[model samples]
Target: MSEALALFASSWFFVAALLAVLSDAFLPLVPSGTLVIAATLHLSDTHTSPFLLGIGVALASFSGDLLLLKFARRGAAWAQRRLERKPGAASAAAHLLAALETKRARTIVVARFVPGGRTVLDLAVGTTDRPPRRFLRWSAVSSAVWATYIVGLGFLNEHTFDTTWLSFAVSCLAATAISAVIARVVQRQRRLARETEAVEPVTVS
Candidate 1:
């Protein structure tokens, strides 16, 4: 196990983290965070610098997010161009654009932690008139915090467990479990809001 850590610590660990985070943006369900935690767990024993690893993860994450938004922006432009030719399409697009601009920062920050959320929010934001500069600023903060959270989890698990692999497994499982619970809570809240709207009484003029 120590020999394996030595090899990974010397090479591939950073590469794996970067690629994993990059792919996770497009593929939403990819286990990028898990990969990071596993790598951290292995390297912790090897005495690798945590700061450097965190930076790699943060930069990779930010790049992936930027790419997603750019792709979304281009796609939105194409759709708008095509839709411009159709009746009422511009009007519909305008409505969506207005809604998206309203909560650009809040959306980006909140969605950063949720699975598959950043993808949807980034795509939506890209379709709006919000400046990329604004998104980038907020994304920098989100990426840093997220990288810290994920890496810190690995350290926590490492300290708690005797076996390195056990630390990896438990960290991944705990993360998954926590995310699942958060998802359920968000889902329930949305459902209740919809139900409340459905049962609201309408006043006649």
Candidate 2:
């Protein structure tokens, strides 16, 4: 138990967490939330504070979001053109942009929880002239919320289960299930919105 605690407390584990979170910003395939939950579960019983780890994860994720946003802004036209070539991606990007136009705060925060929505929203927003400061404000909020939620899941499991591995596994599975459900809900809502928009003009005419 002492050796396990020591390993969890080591600098390498924290660094790995940061890298996972950062890479996840650009690569949706990365299971960054699971890693964060694992880290939190492992360190939950240790002297090291889970809140501190959450903060680190938040900062790292925010940095990655900022970097991607900047890059997207710089190549907005090129990115848009490429997205246009892919019908599915273009439709998703359009939905993100429309949502951003209507409810920037809600979209930003909700997208962080939705699979593949983060990158699409960032790119969609980048194509616009949205103020950098405004984006930063919402981006920070989203990152903090995501970090807190994932870390909280770990802590919840830690408190519920006697075994560390069991707690970690449960937390990860829960997170995955929640993410999948959220993604499906978001996608369904967007599709309905698109259908409504399409029918509105016809009904009006």
Whole-model lDDT per candidate:
0.73, 0.83
Question: lDDT score, residue 114, model 1?
Answer: 73
For residues 1-205, what per-residue lDDT tens digits would candidate 1 score against the true structure? 8887677665676577779898787787788998899878766456777777888888988999899778878898753454466554454334334434676565556566778766655655677767889778878888888888888899889989999889999999888887788667655655665587689698999
Q: Which ten residues in a row have the lowest lDDT in candidate 1?
A: 91-100
TM-score of each: 0.78, 0.89
Over 4 Å off, model 2:
1-5, 44-46, 81-87, 200-205
The 10-residue segment of model 2 with minimum total lDDT is: 196-205
Name every residue pair that clashes in candidate 1: none
**Error of model 1, residue 117, in angstroms:** 0.9
Compute the lDDT for candidate 2. 0.83
* Model 1 vs. true fold: TM: 0.78
Among these predictions, the greatest lDDT belongs to 2
- Candidate 2 lDDT over 180-199, as tens digits, reads 89999998998888788888
